[model samples]
Target: MPRLLWPLLGLLLLAGCASNKERPELTEVDQYREASESLESRNYLTAIDQLKELEARFPYGDFAEQAALDLIYAQYRAVDYPATVVAAQRFMRNYPAHPRMDYALYMRGLANFNMEKGLFDNMVSSDKSSKDMGAAKDAFRDFERLVNRFPDSEYAPDARSRMVHIRNQLARQELHVARYYARRGAIIASINRAQYVVKHYQQTPAVPEALAIMAKGYQRLKQPELAEKSRDVLALNWPDSKFLDNDKQVDLAWWPDEDDGLLSLLTFDLL
Candidate 1:
């Protein structure tokens, strides 16, 4: 061979060797099987990587939908809640009429449900009611949508039960704000918030406190008739309520403390 041709031949042989050593691309089924093995082994992070690669490689393949579902679960198992939520939402949007739509909804709600309890938050023992309820509200809406759309879905019963708990939490959240306002002497704001808990969150434990707030607020505003009405309702429905005094009137303790304390100043005595 000519001198220039010899060098070119050597380069060609090296390229051939490299090509021979290259691994073959995985088939859709192979990728999915690998991902499933990772999941079964509880190697969720590995499964997440494999499932995502499977999705990217076979976006429109036969196993695409299943890969998407598996990715959602893998991310969830890995504690990647935000990613799980996004993957679940994508699945729902892509497969709106899929038979397992309810499952997707349930997972999305569950992801958001646990999103509030990140690692650091879980370490501390804090009151759930006192924490920000944004994620909880989002979770409630998702569960509600699931139950409404798939009343007979296998997940419906659990969704319904979660909704009841969420409702109670939301009621307490509102009452907490109402109490804060009451302590600040923002009587009208307190009354409005309390009424919201009563009207929208009926049957919740917060109702008795809400009634007590309303009755006291009315009395402070010099609306004797409205105060009497609110007091009567509290007496009738929650006779054993802690807010009721021996005389069956709204307990004086239910109202804000008269002393202008540091907490009142810090909270600005306003809602």
Candidate 2:
């Protein structure tokens, strides 16, 4: 009977330990749930504050992990890109093996992407020069990394789509610089930039414009043969491009006199 009493006492002690350990976690989880609800309602500031409290009270617990994720998302939703980046970085550093690691990485990239400025917005209207393209380029690089590393991730398709747009924007910015140089009579500089755009962004919408600019630049430099060649390529690739009208006006008399009639046929002003 004494031995039976000792075993029963041990069972009671174990039960008490289990109860003490579980209650705090349950309470923390309930708090986290409430904070999440606030976030869902778009009360970002309040949600962040609550998430901070939850993290403080349950550091190293299950609720803490969830709190961190919510905190990052709240900062992002609030358009606090800098804070969002920091929080995402911290989360990745602290929870490298977390089940939601892909989400954290994707959020980090998204934070940077959201902070990127369009080239036109950053350009100086007087000179049409950009103050800085670093942020935009960094954003593109970050998104590319995510897509390459997590090809099967839910964010991969969107990342790929955005990358195409980013590439187009970058190409357009370069084209703007080329146009500025062309207008200033800096033929060499303009040709180099336009060529860069044509080579690198041939698939983008800017390609047709870039090719046209290159053709004009070549004509300005007295390279009539090269200019006509570029125009022909542009017409073949983008027959309906607006630049074709301008290409037609560039004189190509330097070509063999007999070929002038053929050049005229190709250069007919469709617009």
- On TM-score, the candidate that comes out on top is 1
lDDT of 1 by residue, 12-123 (tens): 9999999889678899999899999999999999998998898888899999999889889989988999999999999999998999999999999999888878567767
Candidate 2 ranges beyond 4 A from true positions: 1-27, 116-132, 246-271
Residue 105 in model 2: lDDT: 73
For residues 172-221, write the lDDT of model 2, one tens digit per residue: 88887776565555667878998998888879887877777778778767
How many clashing residue pairs are found in candidate 2? Answer: 0
Could you tell me which residue pairs clash in candidate 1? none
Model 2 scores a TM of 0.71
Question: Judged by lDDT against the true structure, how good is candidate 2?
Answer: 0.75
- Model 2 steric clash pairs: none
Worst 10 residues of 1 by lDDT: 254-263
| Cα lDDT for residue 205, candidate 1 | 91
